[model samples]
Target: MATTTASIRVPAPPERVWQLIGGFDTLPDWLPYIPTSELGEGGRVRSLTNEEGGLIVERLEVFDDKGRTYSYSILQAPFPVTGYLSTIAVHEEADAGSSRVEWSGTFTPDGTGEAEAVALFHGIYADGLEALRRTLAAGSAQGS
Candidate 1:
């Protein structure tokens, strides 16, 4: 299995960051690459349309509000990967009043080389985390 992980520190509270990311259908709101998303199965499933018009289907496996984390599995995607499972977590940085967000995934490359799969996921995670940070910062600025 190929694994990829990315982390970012945002100048916001954990609870605030969780509010933006904890929901299964909120990816389009914080993921710049995902321009549209539709939810089904009572929000347990999400069909995301990326900026390039590629579609990806994912199912929510776990959503732990108390733990400030969620996990999901990719049911279908354009990537040459299988058994993809991803987890995202937000943790409070004490004394700084900020939050640290971590996004990690494991998957088996299906024909696509492991190196390519890892690189693709790394870019995806990094872009998503950066978008999340910017979204939170903009929101905070607007509220002040």
Candidate 2:
């Protein structure tokens, strides 16, 4: 299995960050690449539409509101991988009201090298965290 993790520190409270990303169906609100998300199975499953109009279905494996974390497994996606499990978490930072957001994933490459899979996911996570930072900055600017 290949794995990767990426994290970013944002100038916001953990609760606030979690409020934006903690939901199973809230990716569209922050992740621009995921343009739409529809929840099913009472919010346990999420069907996402990517910027390319590709379908990615995922099922929530675990969620912790208090911990500001959630884990999911991808049921279907247009990626060269299988058994994909990912987790996203927000942690309170030592600095006043800042928080650290971490995104990590583990998967077995399908017809690909482990290093390639790791690089792909690491890039995704890193880019996603950057997008999150931009989103949060925009929201703060708007007094949200």
Candidate 3:
């Protein structure tokens, strides 16, 4: 199996960050690459459409609101990966009102090399976190 992880510090409280990302079907709200998303199975599953019109289906495995974390497994995707499991967690930082967001995933390459699979997920996670940070910052500025 291959693993990839990315973390980012956001200038917001953990609860606030979790409120934005905790929903299993909210990816299109902050994830720029995900243009659209539809929920199914009582919100336990989500069908996401990427910017390039690729479809990915994922099922929510665990949603721990108290822990500010959630885990999901990909049922279908365009990437060369399978048995993909991902988790996203929000931790309160020592900084007055900051939070640390960590997103990590493990998977086995379906038809691609391990290095390429890792790199692909790395880039996706990195970009998603950066976009989330920017979105939260903008929202904070507007609210203030």
Residue 93 of candidate 1: its Cα lDDT?
90
**Tens digit of per-residue lDDT, candidate 2, span 41-60:** 99999999999999999999
> Backbone collision count in every prediction?
0, 0, 0
Output the TM-score of candidate 1: 0.96
Q: Answer with 1 or 2, whichever has the higher TM-score.
A: 2
Which pairs of residues collide in candidate 2? Answer: none
Q: Where does candidate 1 stray beyond 4 Å?
A: none
lDDT, residue 139, candidate 3: 98
Better of 1 and 2 by lDDT: 2
Q: Which ten residues in a row have the lowest lDDT in candidate 1?
A: 91-100
Task: Please list all clashing residue pairs in model 3, or write none if there are none.
Answer: none
Compute each candidate's TM-score over C-alphas: 0.96, 0.98, 0.98
Displacement of the residue 143 alpha carbon in candidate 2, Å: 0.9
Candidate 1 local Cα displacement, residue 119, angstroms: 0.8
lDDT of 1 by residue, 1-144 (tens): 889999999999898899999888888778888889999999899999988898999999998999999999999899989999999999889757699999999999998899999999999899899999999989989999
